[model samples]
Target chain A: MKLIIFPPIPSILVSLFVFLALRHFLELRERAPRLNWLLKYLWVLALPLLLVVRITGSRWDTGVFWQIDAVYVVLMVALAGVVLIRLRALQPARTLLVALAPFALYALAKVPDVFLDNLMVFSFGNPADIYWLFSIAWLVGGTLVAYKQQTLLQQQRLEHELEARIKARNQELEQLVEERTASLVRQAGELRETLEELRVTQNQLVQSEKMASLGELTAGIAHEIQNPLNFVTNFADVSTELLGELREEQQRGQEADPELEAELLTDLEQNLTKITHHGHRAASIVRGMLEHSRASTGERLPTDLNQLADEYLRLAYHGLRAKNKSFNATLDTDLAPDLPLVEAVGPDVGRVLLNLFTNAFYAVQQRREQQPGPDYTPTVRVRTRLLPGGSVQISVRDNGTGIPEAVRQKIFQPFFTTKPTGQGTGLGLSLSYDIITKGHNGTLSFVTEEGQGTEFIIELPLSARNSPAPTPGGPAVNPAPQTERSSG
Target chain B: MNILVVDDELDVRALFEQRFRREIRGGQLRFAFAHSGEEALDYLHEHASEVVLILSDINMPGMSGLELLGHIRQEYAAPPPPAPPQVMMLTAYGDDDSRRQALELGASDFLTKPVDFVALKQKLLQLAAHDDAPPL
Candidate 1:
């Protein structure tokens, strides 16, 4: 017996196991380049050769039995050559080892057989059985190792993709934050500029108020002065015409009646007297205007409160009338008969009184315009009283639109105004308050009912009555009578 | 011709009377005076048909010239007196606003003070001639 130790069935079974292991390794070819090429050649050359040699040797009996051993040695040499040449390019050393394990173990199992057969000494009980057993164990172990390596590679690929996405998201968030911060900084700069512009406008408004006051004074002065000046020129012109007529009569010689000449002379004399009177009246008005225009001397003098009130009241009324010729209001004054003089700056006090009177007139005028019914009459009342506490109280009241509740607190604040832009400087009441409370040691206050009326009161102590050298400021009675009107 | 003069100044009456002395004496023109707008309206109400012309001051104590003009235009618009008297406005303010308002309110003419007697006389004479002409 030639010992038939390499049974055909076992041979086919080991080859099949090797085929399945190598197929699994082929799927990981990209991960293990050198080992993948080695396994591919083993599948194509060694597996088929082993099958052909076993079939031929089994049929021919002893004729080609050495051919199987020859083909095995050749396949092993070819696999070793390929693995050695491409070894450096292979990645992940553990998976490469697992992929090449079956081939390497098979080659080792064949080493003793090749040496023993080449020496031609002893054919010891068929070493082919040990080789076949080694083949089955290595193939099964290699397949399991290859499957484990494939799972690890897939997990690593997933982790790398997730890390890249996280980095890109972080970069996007940082860029958004930067853009928002820049926009906020730009808006802050714009707000700063707007505040600066508002401050400049406020300053300009204050300056405009002074100009407005001067303009009002000039208009009032011009209108008041024009009336007397008109009389002066007209009288002078008439007198001249009268003289020409008288000369023409004399030229008529005997035809001229004596009665006509006397009448002409008498008229001429009367006209001259009238001219002088008007001229004097114009001069007095000019004097008062000059005093008004002069800068206040700030010199305190014993001033009659009643006289001061009356003068400012007229001045304020005329000033308003000069701007709007259609404006009219009744003036009611109740001046105290026994009021004593007080030491105060005349122009300063006059300025305070003018501000109060102008405000009262403006309020009434506004109301009258809104309510044009026949029953609505615009009235401003001024009263002076000697209080028992040795102080003089002056109140100016108006039947007009009163101060609204919202603005009452800020009424005397600087740069606060109820009037429209360009009409008021917002300094009138503030300056008046300063002149009364701070300058004269007096109190100025007001009471108001919205949509109805307002009353401003000013109280001054009478301790200055004993001050010597009282300068008597000229005070005149109200020129226009107040009575029930058919239309007001 | 009958004319009414209105002004707040009391001396305006004397000045106008003396200035038109020749015409007044010859009975060519008769003049009446009122010291304020109220007085002028009262006079106008009493002698409704007598006044051929009216001269009024704009700035006055009781009623303004514009207000008086409005009242006159509304109250005396009837044709009984052939035509409503022509109104001439006199103002110390020669501002265009007042002049425009006066014209809009039916004032026939506007004058700024001090009154120019020479120009005034010419205007009065022309008006008198226009009035004296026979109706077409």
Candidate 2:
């Protein structure tokens, strides 16, 4: 059998390579759970095995005995058997122990050689060779352990940094969501406030419309009542004359005949009766005017606008005629069929119709005054129809001396009127505009020409739901020439 | 004396004619009628110096009593204007502003409708007395 000799250069290179590989292995073992088991067992058993192998290999002078070779082969076999068992079991700790066994035996065998060489003082072999091998093994093992500790510390630092970054990211996401939710809530609140304001504006418009209609009625009533009052004054004057004449006859120095006295009494009674009748008639006219002029107050209910117009027209016409029996004008009505019921304050709406009718009557009367000839008898027309977009429109047209263009625009302004100073309050159209536009979410307008006549149109929403609730600072019905009057 | 009753109501004029039957018979008073402010103005223009007093409603279509009063005042304020008749205003609304405006327009007095017959007669009597007196 030939023995292999180790060159000094190869031995040093092998030792350095082995030292580096072992250091790297120990570093990997500490960081990974897979290496934890290996670390425990390799440190315990593999160190001793490597030392034994080293000791035996270097002690060749003790004997070239076959037993030593046998022992070396047996130790190698045992080491290889441990590796096979660890591989088969797939245990990290066992594999590390087996892997270290050969190195440990080599190291141990080197130790024994050193001890033997030193014990024989006269021996020719150098003990320094054995010392060098043992020193190299210790250096390699110490470096591997030191590298393992450093790797473990670095891994812990990485884990802590990763955990902190994750926590910070989650906190930022939560803050962003909260900010977005708060903005949405604020926007929703603002929207609700705007809706509430719109409701308030709508209510104010309706109230103003009612007031305008009442004012118009007041003017009409004043015009209508003046006629009958004139008659009362004249009749009273005439009756006083008759009474004076009767008293003069009684004072005369003559035997007053019972029959003659009775006839005189009868005549006086008849004339007085006529005076009383006429006076009462005038009073009734004034009463009707007052009632019509009062503000409308009623509960909201579903009502047909067409029926309301018809009824009020008749009442207004009769009331006007009662005061001025000589005022002769024809009334015409054009009402649409099958209008849906409108939710409204019934009395309030009725008053509006009454005001419109009376104005129409006065307009015709004015026409008659302007042209006394029989060729032109005054005529008033009232019309109602369902307008587009679910609204009802009512118009009162008069064939009278039409409104002048210059003053037409100013007519709806409060305290603006063509009538004499003592005659008009000028609030009629202004109040009417407010009611229809603001109160009912409706519209009122008129068309006029200097000679043709005037037509007033009122548009009202058909249903309560279609009418928007009043809102504060929302668009309100404005009483001006644009809305109140038109020129054709 | 011939008198004209201006009013829009036929019944009112008829009542006046009925009450003054004795005056008509004795030739103490004669009556004519006009139904509107314009008519009354036209009648006054035609009858120049014949009317004793003008009683009018302040509220009337086309022209009101106050406007008529202004016209009357203007006519009388001029030179050689025919005997200025006494003017009175009657109205349903007796608001202070309206009454003040009427009186300022040279109306003799303002009365509300329905006027008291006795009071109106007394006013007419006083006006007639003044008419008989010489102008200041």
Candidate 3:
């Protein structure tokens, strides 16, 4: 048989193409999952078949070809079948094992041919074909291994970068949440302050309404009392003249001197005295009621605070007694001797004192009610003292059942009253507070214990009487009195 | 002399009438009563030239006595017509504001309620004396 020759250059080219095809199949499988099975099958079987066809071209009739060619065909066919099975199962290890088996067999089959040829040629076999086959197999196997190593390295690098980006995003989200939470907390604090301010404003408004109603009621009562007082004064005047006439008749002895003249004179004197006394008392009562009912009237003036307190205290006590005849409480005043004259509206200041006196009276009465005995006489002490820095401190103290702690804090609040509904407008203390504090540029505060008693303290700056006119939206300052002292 | 007493309370008007009974019957003064500011104004309108004096309460529902006085002042701004009544304000509230307002509104004088008859008589006698005097 003619010597068969296989072109070495074409075989090398086929092996090179097989390597490229395997690379393309791997890229397709990674990038596109839908085409992965098809690409893997082509990589495992088709490329190898093409390699064989190229290596065996025009060399089929050689005697040695029949022997090695059949073995090559069987091994190639077995590789194809294993690769096809692996593709169906999609197993990476199985595919690699099947691919490596045929490559190993092909390399080993060329060993015998190399040994025999070397022995015949130069007392040593020519091993060129075996060497070529073994080198080709090694190239294919090494290329596959290198490709796998490169893919694993690339996957590890991508995972590390992705993990870093995720951590950064989570940190940014946490910071945003913190900032939003802080803003919400700030807004809540502002809302709470606003609510407290609104509550104070509402209290002021209710107190003003109560003052208006009380003014109306006092005015009405004063009108009703005026006529009786006038009658008392008139009758007393008439009786005095009649008594004078009777004494003149007795001196002349014009009538029967049955001692009727003396008796008539004495009776007239007593009746006239009683009538005059009661008439003046009623007149004072009306005046006090009138002052209490009146609203702020004129500009502020420099006032003798001690005298003002005394007059209002008298009126307040009488007014309380008039309402409840059994309500008898002694009031003691401890006015400062050298208290500097403070400028304030006399009528308005009088009203504030009246409120305090009335409240003290009520507190003492309440205490008396709780303790049942003849000796349970209630007493209210009103004292004024000159403080350093031209300030005056006035306090009203009562030995009454003190306010409970739970309600003590709320006493100055408008509409918060311990008295029964009809008896109190509930604005008295709040109005008094406003008058002393905001209206007079002073301070009003109180202290109380459960069983001991209660005391309301007011401090006024002497300069407050001459305070400048209040601007709109600013707190109201009391108007100063306009007149100088005339007579007591 | 005809006197008009204006107040909202019926009892207050009755008390005034009772107190002035002697003067009213003797024809030294004739009594007329109006229960509200509006009623007083209407009476004044009809008897403008006849009323000798007016005693009015300052606080009344609807139109106050002060408002009535204001109307009277406006109507009699010039030399008052014949027998134009002298107006006096009577109020339970003796505040300076009311007093100033009353005086400003041309009220001749003011007296607080629970009135003293002696003081009232003295004021009436003084007003009568002033009325007897010729206008300067």
Q: Which stretches of candidate 2 lie over 4 Å from their true place?
A: A1-346, A350-457, A460-488, B4-15, B18-21, B33-36, B92-105, B109-112, B122-136
Q: Per-residue alpha-carbon lDDT of model 1 for B1-136, expressed as tens digits?
A: 8999988778887888888887788877899998877888999989988898999988775577777788899887765644688899998877898899999999999999878888998889888878778878
**Cα lDDT, model 2, residue B111:** 87
Quote the true-contact fraction of every model. 0.52, 0.26, 0.07
Model 1, span A1-488: residue lDDT tens: 43343443333344446544544544436646656665655546546655776666555234244445434544553453344334423333345455455556555555565545542322545465555556556655754765665567667867888888888887887888888888888988998898788668744653455446656766666666667777778778888888898999999999998899999899889888888887876675566555555655667788888977876677678889888766887777899999888888776777788889999999999998999865877888899999888788999989899888777778788767888997887788876776676557677888888788888888887655432332244212111111211112
lDDT of 2 by residue, A85-184 (tens): 4344333324445445555555455445544432333222544445545544554564455455446645776888888888888888889889988998
Winner on lDDT (2 vs 3): 3
Candidate 3: segments with Cα more than 4 A from true spot: A1-37, A43-204, A207-209, A212-304, A343-352, A371-373, A404-410, A413-415, A421-441, A447-452, A464-488, B1-136
Q: Looking at candidate 2, what is the lDDT of residue A375?
A: 78
What TM-score does chain B alone reach in each candidate, compared with the true chain B? 0.94, 0.81, 0.86
Worst 10 residues of 2 chain B by lDDT: B16-25
- Rank by lDDT, highest first: 1, 3, 2
Tens-digit per-residue lDDT, B1-136, candidate 3: 6678897656454445445545555655677899887798899888777787999987654456777887787778777456456798887667777788789878888988757676886776666667656889
Task: Estimate, for each residue in A1-488, the C-alpha lDDT of model 3 and write its tens digit.
Answer: 32222332333334345434643634435544544464344335545544565576745444334444434444543543453444433333344455555555654564465335321222114455455455556646755764575467467758887888888888888898999889989999998898788778865664455465455335334433554465565556556555666767768766646575665566566556656665766675566556555556646678788877775665565455545433556567898889878877666667677777778877887887788664665778889999876788888887777777667657776667887877777677776776766667777777776656777777777866455443456543222212211111
Candidates in order, interface RMSD in Å: 2.0, 8.7, 13.1
The CAPRI quality class of candidate 1 comes to: acceptable
Alpha-carbon deviation at B113 in model 2, angstroms: 3.9
Better-scoring candidate (lDDT), 1 or 3: 1
User: Per-model C-alpha lDDT, please?
Assistant: 0.72, 0.61, 0.63
